[model samples]
Target chain A: MGLPRKDRIRAKLKSENTTVRVLLAHPMHTGRAKDEADTLIPAEFIQDIRCWRNDEEVLTIKCGTATARNPYFSFQLVGGKQGDMITIRWVDNRGAKGTTETVVK
Target chain B: MTDDIMQQRRAILKGAISASTLALVAASGLLLPRQLLAHWPKNAFNAETVEDALLALLGEADIADDAALNFKVGSPPSYAINGASVPIQIQSDLNNIERIAVLVENNPFPLAMSLELTPAVSLPIKSMIKIREDSPVIAIIRAEGKLYKTSRFVEVDIGGCG
Candidate 1:
């Protein structure tokens, strides 16, 4: 239940802003599902996500178990230029973490 | 004299306006302690019911049905995720958007995600959420120190994505 997941991040320069999309691979277990053995799986979902633009923290996302598996999120970042670095870090309820980074292009 | 009545009405209106202003000041005052000790808002996300979730997150605040805070779910059946993931696109013309959240009324865990964006982030967000069945998906936005919401019913044809 405390397994780490993979992350994919993409940041692109748009008209007036840079759009960033992040995809996280997680089971997002709700503690309600059962395996073939019929045991409840522990809830293991992302609880906190922090987005960073270079050194400054840009935003924080609070997510629950209801977020889909392999969650995808996209947002537009203003004043972003090509080659700027964007980073995403997340921690799930099980204390597992995933971090992804990309350069605006 | 009718002039006396007009004066009284104006005085009452002025008092009402000041009262509302004071109330606004007091409300923002409550946020100071919260910001000082901000966390993941566990009570809100843990709430099972929509009313409880809203109350826990935003307090007993007024919510306006805003048409400007619009959200679209995939309808071309391609957006019709046969599984748990349902894509949603949200765009808002409202100003001063401090926070945005998505909730599915029927999900066992209602609050899917909440975003705290800085001025650097613009609107027209696209995201995915887990929906088990047919339910109303509500997007709540905090803009201009007020809460605005718009909702749409999403039908999930299949079950868990796991």
Candidate 2:
């Protein structure tokens, strides 16, 4: 099977902008954790994240291992209306990727 | 053979096989460097100083203090109990901001995180970051080819990087 879908995205239309919140399921290993066998778990984390609004790029984040597990991010869109498309995609250290979309409500 | 002896023999064989398999994988170079696995931005994260990290990420250009730029930082109490994960939010009113970066001045890796904004995005970028000790948290923004900066001091009881 392919990588699991682990992202939850939501968008809401506010008075003057749109709010987007994203919760991504990830280990965010800091390259320091060790297993029961004492093997160092390699650092695996989301390196890049991009958010698009109706095919228009709005925000991009560059992350590192310091990010916590199941990282959460929230940002605002300058102008968006109901039914507008908001898409977010991220790629992790293992080359695993996930994308999720929501409509502003 | 007795049951105990048979069990011991099987355990030893299993261990030997797994050890050899691990060695083979290591020797074959199947495990790539950790940096290659992600866009780690080694230079910025490895920089010894905040200035160095900013230079590596944003170039060695002069940053001007602009009064027109409305930059605000939202964080917890002045003293944080847990430095490993401190919630922070940045909001600005400067027009046409293209990039925003957060820096923890005293962290081993001062450059905490950064965000690139497009025209469709608004201000107020929120996230969590680790802080090594009591330090000034800086927020830098790039707009119209100029860099605007702001900072707030935060005291940590226990350092994050143990």
Candidate 3:
């Protein structure tokens, strides 16, 4: 609700042997300092990640501030045909959520 | 065998061994490129919010939660660095992902960390960035062409820049 923005993944179907790449956008903000007006900006960042293909869970991860911004990723799958779909989702420290999709051909 | 015959046999064996080794190395090249760039999320930059930073980093079409992406973070940081190292991490269980991102809740600039993934490897991203004061940390991911988000609140121990 009042959490920060989140991201998701999507894709088109492709050949069973074809592989795909994905990268989500986020900030690994470390709560540290204040602003010009003497205001404090709290620390916020990502904590976990998960993905699926054709309604089947495939991968999962647990991360923290040590990570960089807009993390990048790539993976492969078998038995995929053109026009198929790929989906991804993630959550951030603020409870914010985001979703996205893609089509492989 | 005679002296001449022995020398010829040694020469032939050496040539055969060298040729076979070279061929083997070349054959392996076919699968090398895919293995190199097949991973995702290689670059990272800072931003102020989840929406602005993500759009600047991942692109428009690659976002979805039905993708079932998930993430977590610390309840609230109990310390501060006056704009120094802020510990944090973002992890995704999605097998088809290549990158992840993090952001700050109240920072003048939010977007913080991002990481790229490689096949046959787990895509867990972590890092610490500068923060102003008390705020929440946000985490996001783009796996298999979808996106997801999460956040955590942190309390500063010492006040510096603030």
lDDT of 1 by residue, B8-94 (tens): 999999999999998997787965754632478999898999999989888898999989887887565234656477888889988
Per-residue lDDT tens digits of candidate 2, residues B74-108?
A: 34545677776677777767889888888888876
Which runs of model 3 end up more than 4 angstroms from their true locations?
Answer: A1-105, B1-48, B61-83, B159-162
What is the Å distance of residue A14 in model 2 from its true position?
0.5
- DockQ of the candidate models in sequence: 0.55, 0.36, 0.06
**In model 2, where do residues sit more than 4 Å from their true spots?**
A1-5, A33-39, B1-42, B65-75
Off by over 4 Å in 1: A1-5, B1-38, B77-79
Pick by TM-score: which candidate is best?
1
Q: What is the interface RMSD of candidate 2, in Å?
A: 2.1
Top model number, DockQ: 1
| Residue B37 shift from truth in candidate 1, angstroms | 7.1
Q: Would you estimate the TM-scores of all the predictions?
A: 0.82, 0.75, 0.39
How much is the lDDT of residue A48 in candidate 3? 51
Chain B vs. true chain B: TM-score per candidate: 0.73, 0.68, 0.55
Per-residue lDDT of A3-88 in model 1, one digit per residue for the tens? 24567889998886999999887877878888889888888888888899998788888998888777789988878788899999
lDDT of 2 at B154: 85
